[model samples]
Target chain A: MKTTETPAPPPAEPGASVSEVAAPVAGPPRRKKEGAVLNVFSHGVLVIWAIMVVTPLLWAVMTSFKDDSSIFGSPWALPDRLHFGNWARAWTEANMSGYFLNTVLVVGGSLIGTLVLGSMAAYVLARFDFPGNRFIYYLFIGGMSFPIMLALVPLFYVVNNMGLLNTIHGLILVYIAYSLPFTVFFLTAFFRTLPTSVAEAAFVDGASHTRTFFQIMLPMAKPGLISVGIFNFLGQWNQYMLPTVLNTDPDKKVLTQGLVQLAVSQGYKGDWSGLFAGLVMAMLPVLGAYIIFQRQVVQGLTAGALK
Target chain B: MQHGKYRFIVGFLAVPLGLYALFVVWPFIQSIYYSFTDWTGLSPEFKMVGFDNYKRMLHDDIFWKSLQHSLLFALVLPIVTISLALFFAFMINVGGRRRRGGPAITGVRGSSFYKIVYFFPQVLSIAIVALLFQFAYNPDSGAINSFLRGIGLGHVQPLWLGDPSLALWCVMAVLVWSTTGFFVVLFSAGMASIPGELYEAALIDGASRATTFFRITLPLLWDTVQSGWVYMGILALGAESFAVVQIMTTGPGGPDYSTTVLVLYVYQKAFRDGQAAYATTIGVALLVVTLAFAAIVMRLGRRERLEF
Candidate 1:
């Protein structure tokens, strides 16, 4: 307990990384030798993990360009020549283009819906004092812990009864509904943190409640919106179970569902190279997005867990 | 001002709340009610059959197997993943040598690079990860067996997903591989908030690396660790496990039902077998297990919160 509450040291060294600062405190010579050996061991383990993570992904890309026989012949070898044709075959012939478009449509509609609806509810819950306010808030949050599969069971029939089982719009509505729990949970907390001064001032100027939320509060909540947006975007984009059960239409299949279906059906056709091409094609966009937005992605994901 | 306040609040909450009720809350309530009935989900007309499904679940071999596997997943995946994550986080954040002119603590060289690469799998869908590993675990032309034969382990060949004994562990390994990085990144963030002075104080006291970690870092990071446990356990028992098992295994949960979990069992029974009511029975059991797992972790991990 004594060690835990030690005050942060004065910033005697200004340019050091946030992770560690050279505390301007010296240690005995014995610690130096131990540090030297520990550095090597740490690097060794980190390097091994990095290798383990990258090798399979790289192998998938390599196999995508190889011919069928070569993929089986030398799993680790470079392709004899680049086969951009395999990608073409996957894109057009394997209907990956269709799956990609369906995914975009579903995730796009649902993301926008989730953000709008989630923020409205979050704003009201955060700002207003109303009847059953706590009840409504916990109702949204309780959805987070219960098994979605349990809901999904009756959800299937409800969707069917509503004539929403296999349609893109139906899928979008369900996505928004399921996504509401976390979105509201996150943004309600975010809304409460915003200084009430701005919104209160706007209310004093006689801006209607709806107008104030749309113009004033929404723009102010941009950072929180972006964080939870990225979270839902990735989740809805990679979704498989919902589509597998609900949207079983071949033409409406999302990327993850389509690829798994392809692997299962491609066994008879022996289009291993095309299948591998399709697999890598589905991975590149999100992987590239993460590389570009690496920092925000980590913050968005970790923030939910930390809270 | 007071005239429209209630109306405004109701208008704001209406759509999201209504959608949540229709899709999420209503279904959850209906499933619990369905669990005691005899609805096949084919025609959806049925009568209540009290405790029949529960009674059958007790005697059913497949139900027991799935329950056992689900329990294993919830128990083993968190321990293995979190421990590995904790070690890597320590190495990356606090394991560097105390350089002569540098801070008293630093991560090893290239910490950022390792972090970036380790996080690659977390972005990709688990379905994609499962598929990639499925090919790699191929007995004949897959990478693992090929590497083994390449290294003169020519006489040794193991059917990874094909053999029942090895199949479950292989599936769990994929979950661990795909998930550990997220926790590593999570723990790294937790460690970053710890003041450098604490570590400096420990170093000045002649404490070894392991001693400082167990004594200082672990206690400070306890809350994050506990929450991470619940998060990972819920994931292990939920859709993530369902994706890997359905995609990678032989019968999609078989080599004689070796890798089938409660989620997979629920899926198979409801969708494939047309036993929706019975599926809800199993799903209710799963809900019980999931909540129990979380409650247990929270109870066991309870400790004095260390303010820093």
Candidate 2:
């Protein structure tokens, strides 16, 4: 893969000194002009990309509100009027509501389970000296690098053999299990960074290990939890591959899987508008959550990679 | 403090470890073993077939095709996505001209807005993004073709996901669109930590924009970039490719398995064709490719650390 490193542009003329220390008042007019051009070029490129990223999303939202004819006929046109009917139909008839509920139940159960189990494990791995600690820590973090699809084939059967297939709790358990890798990996590092004094003091104050964790350490680890929490929240919420394989029951499908199913079925039923509505409906919650929690979301997602 | 230390460790470790071992680790081991079996996945009874599945895979045309496509995804996606992200990130974090009373290095105007808007696609599920782009790529009445027509380029219309020749590119483009923002944000964070004094020094030496970037930004950001490459490459090979190819391409994998990736092929083989053993064989190959990809990138990217 070519990294595409460009040859550096020739250096500025030696005699033309425009460094801030050398010339505070004004750069050479030529330098000013060059800066103006580069500024426009950079901003222009950034703007175009921003547009490319936003346009399809806005199009999906617009198409969701349009009639079938308008949607098929004019791909770029705005809907003549807002069609609340599409949203209502999608919510009630297309089973978007059911899908949303399933997603919430699955993500909620899995997120809470992941954080509790993951942080508990991470705290111990970070703090205590114990036999097999290093081995166990590597074991959890090892899941972070391996391709999950490799495990998923047998995992499908594993879940099925346990009579857990196509069940909400089953999917929740699988989500938590899979999520533990990253959550543990991230929170382990995070837990290590935290001050050990308070937890030790809590332990000395006649608190049990569990009590210290629940009260002093857990609260102190709030920032780390929020970071990894948002990470798992988005991941479990948007999860498609896991549910697609394990939870095939129509009633149990999560939002992402449900939306794809709707698209497939809606194609034949000529419910394009409703499909788009469902798409938008499914898209809104995460996007909204992201916008509101933008900073944390970025931090949460990037934290693993940065480490 | 030491009274029940073992108990505390076991109590905390047991549940998560139990769940992970049962679901993640055990299945991983089982899949490797299953790769050698003659199990149909449809039936419980089966005998060890040794490397029969692996032997079949060597001759299997679709397996080869999927591997080729998967390799292509792993190679090309990271290059394109990382380049775009690095460019956007540089513009956002370091490409701006110095403004009055501002630090020597600063992002262009509205960089934060661009970062936010660019990240919109990353927040949405890949399946949802794939579905959106599938419509956009529709050859007949899709946004792309109609947009071409609007621009008076009606004579030139390409069947995006439908045309096998262009189908893979279309899917790759969707991935690039969805993922570039993530790396942009990631590299931005990397760049944010870089000291402004480096840029100031470069400027003092009469370094051009390109010079400062190649000399200062890229070297310092090398570690993040290397890791990001591996991360993106894995995504391209694994779940991300599965969603986009499965959801977007019709034929499901496309005009004639042109877009069939290893993950999709694995899903289809075990789930659709009942070739569970063979599916695991392919899964094993995928795991190998993934590891090899990570290892090679890391090896190639290893360089003397540029301490700030």
Candidate 3:
């Protein structure tokens, strides 16, 4: 708010070399005869790995376009004609719509609750020296390593006791609760890295803490919020274990569970094309979101790990 | 002012704290308590059977087998995935040779392209990956066998996930395939953090690529690598191990329990077999082993971290 935003000055530490801070990437090294060979070798390996990552999805898509006979005939050939019916059959007959809707409601609700609650908690912990702040922070950190399976039997009953079993609300509450650790973990660290001067100015302007946070600080923390938001969106959207154990009604099943059931049934009944369609249906939205936020996906996963 | 500060803190903190306590922290405490009882999942009433479940676990062959699978997964997953992750990340970040006293090295020719492509599988739910692989592994029409036969190798094409002998390894291969990209991205970030001057200094000293990786990159990225190790290691034993198996395998564990992991065993017992107490018993043991494995790895992963 004070100075012109010219890419904010580099960190104020000595020996923070211009190249190290500014251009962390380096150019080509000095003479090394074997480097060309190594580059080829690296490309060879990466290309093969890339193919490994890609082929299955491609295979599934292509297979989805083919009927049973074509898929069974030539694994490598293009479909004689695209079969859009498989996708329609999957969306309607497989009950994927109901599941997709349930997932949308649960994940959408969980994301909002998690961001609001997590940011509030993160803000307080980052800004104030409250009693038990360290303890509360560690309490959240401690949940990160604890296996979800270890807590399953008891968590089942906890949700049940709260009368939230077999409901979207229950799933949302649990998702928000478990996601708190990760959400708080990243946001707390992120909040700490922000300059406190902005919030101080807000406070001096006669704003309440709530007003300061919602109007000033939260927006300043937008990049952090987005990173963690992207992280949570993918995670809760893909969440399987908690939802599987928690949300069990056939109509109430999330997309992952529904897709699993559809896949298993399709396999048993030999609806291979329909199975492929179901897989694609379950995959497209998440894939679209991932593509849009590809940079954030990389940033969030790495930061989440290191943090 | 003091009173207002306290109120502000409580106002901000109350909801998250209450929910965390109820859902995350409390379940852990309850699981420890539940492990000793004989409570079926549905029954409110049960008798306390002290250490009986643990005793049963000692004689339980399936329990032992599941643990072995988890141990095997924990061992093999990091060796294969992390090694590949480090290699790819190193190549992406430092494989290119650069001019002296110039900007940092470029990644491989198409680094961002490769990264996005590599990380494609990551966004999908594990169930989607599992199902995709399951179809790909189907002996009759699946991609693996079909491709193998198409390429003039019909005689050696094995039933991948269906064969009892190959089932477990096939499942682990899926885990590796789906997970490796994230680690690659992780290691690349760590690689990016290593300043340009160190590589230049090392180049001046004539360090080979392998030597630079093992000597410079690996040591500097040790801590970041350790957490990733702990993560990949614990995944071997987590409920996630169940998701793949449950989605991909024939039975819950399939082909005579070949792909059964500890978490699957717990899920089966608690959910299918209705042995909630015994499942919690297994869950407790899993908790101990996972934490211990993580602790031991982190302890060993500690080195005199370079502070450049």
Candidate 4:
């Protein structure tokens, strides 16, 4: 329960000047010749690793633009003609438009469900002193360790019995179940970090628990909620197995499963240009979201993992 | 006030608790029951088979081999992936601290480029990765063997996903590449949590960079390490080995069951072969294994929480 206190800030603009931060601390100055050599060496290694990491993605992008002839003949070259139509064909032919819509609905449904329910559960666990509270918390933690695949068969049966198969609702329910563990774990930790005084003061002023949670607590837990939402979104968006098993109808298929079906059906015919294009398009939202919220996601992941 | 508190707790707990019970607890109970009974998926008439399936599984060579392969894959993947990830994280974390004249090359600021690169494969679906590797490993038009031939190492270019001996290893390499970035991100975050003051203190004490890392950083990040291990291990166990196997080998287990894992085996048995009871039994067994391993790791790794 011990929380680390933030240090006093040197200035309001924390990220503005590294020099200012370094200036206050008396430290050994870098040796001239040695620093130069190490600097060059470090940059050299980083550049090499960067190239290694970026190469395949660059290859995919380039390949997507390549004409069928150039794909094999000049495998590594820039396309002679930028075939933007490949993307258009992928969108139309691969039925990616439908798949994209399915993914959006599934991801959106799961994110909203997990965040709302998870935060409520977390609020109770963090702020309450009730019978079986600790035990209930552990139960949720145990859910984290439960492999969804183990429950795959029974889950399929249950979904079928509910007549929810091949529907967006069915996929959302499965995602909510699968995501509860991690989301609860994260939001619980985050809720604990919130000072209880605010909620208590609100309660003293006659605000109902629900009112306090929604108006005060939930708003305060925005970062945690966003982190959980992003995690759930990525997971749901990229998800393959649950949808594949529970929803086999092509119209109901999410992007991952849809792309898989497309690849399998057309891969051998050397028509994978569309598959690669679809793959690239599917990767866009995730990459864009990650880039925008890179800081939050990185911090959230680390904190969650360490906890 | 007391009554209000109780009401609050009940209200807050209702939704998640109900969902967990229905989706998780109920299904879990049903699975254990189904494992005991001889229930074909299509037929509701199933007798209480007792432990017959478990007994049969005792001598089942494919089940045993699949389990062995799963265990081996689980064992090796975590070690390899975590090691590589830790190395990269450490390099990025410490290497950034050294004052470089030209640019901030080795730190988080510069390392963002690497982050995007490493995480690229994660964005690609496993299916896409499987298909890509399929073409990449194609002997005739494969980029891998072609590169080897071009480099005068053609003899060393074994059929990556074709040869039974090399298929598992090739699959493992792809898994490693796909996942290493996730671990790198995890490890970097762990390293980030260790206050710069600790490193400064260690440096002031005349500790070398390596010594500080081993003594301060590694010990401090044990929780993250444990978390990464458990997460990766569970994923490695549950993931479909069949994706790559199906794409590369053209069969269930590929090149004589070398790449077969338990999930794929269950998939084939139940869906492909229509042995619902057998598949459910295998699923039950995998459940037990996963739970047992998780329990052991959690128990062993338990320590008093570290205050940063």
Candidate 5:
């Protein structure tokens, strides 16, 4: 058996697990338990859970707006009045704005690069019955199984040798590179599900494979692309370890590392409210993006879970 | 056309394959090499003092302590996270009876709303979650203590992340809080596709919710649960869980390193101590443990086959 046959623990035939359970139950009516008690119980459990999940986040937002010392006096109280100064101080003095811009640039570049290159490779691997196709496919997927930090020191060496460390573009390239395995794995599965006749027909009609992929095929694979795109966006935006290791330049640090440093500094200085503001700043973009594309983010991320 | 196909594959594969090789594959290969030698990671000159670092690792008390922590997480986090996730997922997906009264399975009235809120943490950065929890777990004025006081349980309030005895448990609780909703959504989706007839059959057979969950839902979704187990195990083993430790704890991973974990040890060794080679040795040990844990889990999963 190939070493690659050792299943990467990250993505269990997630599709099978999630998809099988999520299989549309739109068919015939069956005699089932008429338990109103169960329904009410389910609702109650779900409500409590939702509150448990949301309360901390809401509290963080509330705390970010309160006076730093006042928070100690009234821990659970809603802010007496919204102190918007924390946000300004966090952005201007604590340097969250810089981190935010750095994150946006890196994540943006990484997303586009990953989508284009990942989909290209995924299309070929999924479509062509070529020699070494399985080998290449496994090579990409195998990246996911191994612990990532094991490679950090050597990766630092390589990135340094290439003179890419401490640069936003450097971070972008690394993010894009690391993201490929999952993107390729996901999109390959997605592409294989697309009807082949369309691509075959496009080829017959004088379109090159690239054009077919770009025009006839990519458009068809839009749902998959959007799903994986959002997945990469979230993953890259929240990255902490890589930036911490590779980018020592404070100006280029991502929001995650910035917040940790800010929090640590504030922990010593006792600027609790401003620290909360930094956490909020680091949070809002991804949270805002998620709220807008919650379905796609959820669906795209959980793609393997269902199949 | 044959040459054209080759050309096309080459064109598509070139950039991604190159980047993967240069960044991921080569670094992985080189890290193994680095693990073997005594290199400070700064100079070009270094000696291959084979097995010396590995020898040191065998004696490091903190390393062993952190490994114990990793094992505890591997064992405990999965139990708590999976149980809650499964129970809640089952509740959301299959607990609801038909509104009109029958065995027709439907999700609770606001399952979608419940799902979105439950899944809110999955989107936020772990750093943010950890920081948020840092505030929540503040021994003096944090939400947890405040609530405890409000509930008239002021005497029982723990220092949470501050108290050395309770520190690791608080971290685990936070980890569970952040990740449980994700599995809930996952299991919900898994349960969604299960035929309502199965539940009806279980109901007709006089199975209780717990019994039906074990016999019908669980047996059917064992594969999903197994995968979830492996994923949880892997996460528990890795440094990702240390985001909270990195944020909330003092002394890098303290109350006197009470919450210290293996990956955090590796990070400290490489970056803080500048003992890069020794750090790589520890990384290798981590790799071995993670792979072994995954293998063991996979084998156990294959052993229990409820083939219907």
Candidate 6:
């Protein structure tokens, strides 16, 4: 994926040099000719994979527009007409609007909280040569391997004790805790990559650690921050397990759990179309984010995963 | 000045550290403590169980079966997903060559499209994924059987999620499909950073494509592969079975507990069966298994950092 971003091709070989190589036993010419054919075959394979991957999603969208009968009767056919109202009904009838708002609140609050807290911790870890810095960093990174399910029983206890069950705030707090490790790990790498000169300059001036982080370091780390935010947003938005186990009240449900309820209620009755519609509706926010933040999210996933 | 710097560092570190301690660390400690005590989730009445839960867990067949399922998932998932991802990533990476008057075939036909397509499952909620697959794997009118019947392989269609023997494999297939794209994107990026000259040099030396791939590509790509392996292993241990069990299967894992995984059993024991302490013991068992798997993978598969 990153290879596609390089615009300049490798410097072209001189024409005479290419022709000199081409004169030998039809070797160079044959290789060059075969290269073209190989490229074509490569594209063919990719195109086929793309079609296979996209078909299910296309089926989903098409099914969303069909009535219940047409969905099974003509699975591959286009909707007789685009029932735009399924989307509308999905929103209003399913109370997807409330779920959407809950998702945004949960994702947004978690994103902001994760970035602020995670970046601050990353800054201290990366910049200061403090005692136990490595230990603290390890502590955060170790949290990465701690299964949320391990904490599930205890998390319920803690949240229930705090009277946070079913509240968006409770979900937000859990999201923050769950998200912190990756965010800190990624941001620490990002901060370390920053030329030390910038932070050193800030230190030489009267800028305090907090001021340097917020003013100079944060702006410089925009790409990293944006990438991390998009990753966290996707994680929180598509989240199912946390919300399912945390918030039981339908009114407090996020899009994920709401879609589950919609499926359970509608699926057995052969309401596949409605279920698909709800699925499509639930996918919109992440789809929008993907379209907007495609490059950064890919970069973040690459960098964070590889590190 | 030294005292002031110490104060400043302490102040900067306090909030996040405090939250982590309270929410993450303290809970971990409390979980360990709770595993040894008898406490129902709802009521305050409790007793010191004194390793009773763990001792019972040792003899419980279900507990062992769940552990085996989780271990099986962790072992198999990375191998299947990573191999497929590597293949796809290589295809997409090398696929795009400039053709006459096209808008840079890379974006339209190359890694970007692969990125988006593969990431579709990642963006959808797991509930949606499970439900979608539930219909896809439906015994009577599901897409898989329909496609099989449409082709000449009409006799080969199996009840995917319905058959106990096939259900676990069916769930694993969905997991592989959903996650392989994520690894493909990651591996492709890792592949991209390798200098093009290296491949050219190998080609110039009369190395076949297979030789170049095995010798140059796989060795250099080991770090990304290991990272994906460890991460997937941890997730496999924790949530892979939990998510599918919660969504698609019945309690105690499904179809005579063929799909019962450790976390789900813990969930059932804690919430459904009202055996909180026993369930906590199951969770601790899982925690131990995950840590052990992670440690082994990290130690054995550790690769030197790629400079590029």
Predictions in order: lDDT: 0.89, 0.87, 0.83, 0.73, 0.80, 0.76
lDDT of 1 by residue, A1-307 (tens): 0111122332521223333333324555666556545655565656667767787898899999999999998898899999999999999999999999999999999999999999999999998998899999999998888888888888999999999989999999999998999999999999999998988788889998998899999999999999999999988988877888898888888899999999999899999999999999999999999999999999898888888
Q: State the lDDT of candidate 6 residue by residue for B12-89, as single tens digits.
A: 778788778767877787788889998888787888979999899999999998898889999998888888787778
Chain B alone, TM-score, model 5: 0.95
User: Which has the higher DockQ value, candidate number 2 or candidate number 5?
Assistant: 2
> What are the chain B TM-scores of all models?
0.97, 0.98, 0.94, 0.87, 0.95, 0.89
The best-first sequence of candidates by TM-score reads 2, 1, 3, 5, 6, 4
Q: Write the per-residue lDDT of candidate 4 for residues A1-307, one digit (tens) a residue.
A: 0000111232422432343234222235553333334434544544454554565566777788877766666455678888888899899988999989988888888889988998999989988888899998998888777656657777777888899888899889888988888898898999999998988898889898889899999999998888777777766776766776788897889887887788778756667677778877877777777777777766655557767
All models, DockQ values?
0.42, 0.49, 0.37, 0.28, 0.36, 0.34
* TM-score against native, each model: 0.95, 0.95, 0.92, 0.87, 0.91, 0.88
Candidate 4: tens digits of C-alpha lDDT, residues B1-308: 45478888898898898898888878777877777877777766888899988888888998998898888877888889898788677767765544545332235335666765666666556666776666666665565665566656658667767788887877777777678888887888777767777776776686755676678878887788877888878877785454545444557577787888887777677656756777778888787877777666677667533432
Of the candidates shown, which would achieve the greatest DockQ relative to the real structure? Answer: 2
Per-model TM-score (chain A alone) = 0.90, 0.90, 0.86, 0.84, 0.84, 0.84
Q: How do the residues B124-219 of candidate 1 rate in per-residue lDDT, one tens digit apiece?
A: 999999999999888899888877777677686788899899999999999999999999999999999999999999987889999999999999
Q: Candidate 3's residue-wise lDDT over A143-210, tens digit each? A: 88888887878899989988999999989999999899989999999999999888887787788888
List model 3 lDDT by residue over B86-168, tens digit each.
Answer: 99998888886564464645676567877888788778888889888886787877677766776576786678887999999
Residue A68, model 4: Cα distance from true site in angstroms:
3.0
Which run of 10 residues does model 6 chain B get worst, by summed lDDT?
B101-110
lDDT of 5 by residue, A54-159 (tens): 7777788889999977789878888889999999998899888888888889988999999999999999999899989999999998877677778887888789
A130, model 4: CA deviation in Å?
2.4
Taking the tens digit of each residue's C-alpha lDDT, what string does model 6 give over A1-307? Answer: 1111122222332332243234334235655566545545454545555555566676777779988777776566689998877877778887788888988898889889989988888888887787899999999888888877767788788888999989999889888988888898998988998998887787788787677778999999998898888788777877887887889999999988888788777756666676788887776666677767777777766667877
Comparing to the true complex, what docking class would candidate 3 get? Answer: acceptable
TM-score of the first chain of model 4: 0.84
**On a 0 to 1 DockQ scale, where is model 1?**
0.42
* Residue B272 Cα positional deviation in candidate 2, in Å, after optimal superposition: 0.2
- Give the per-residue lDDT of model 5 (tens digit) for B69-137: 888888899889999899888877776544444445665556677788888888888888888888778
True contacts kept of 3: 0.76
Model 6 TM: 0.88
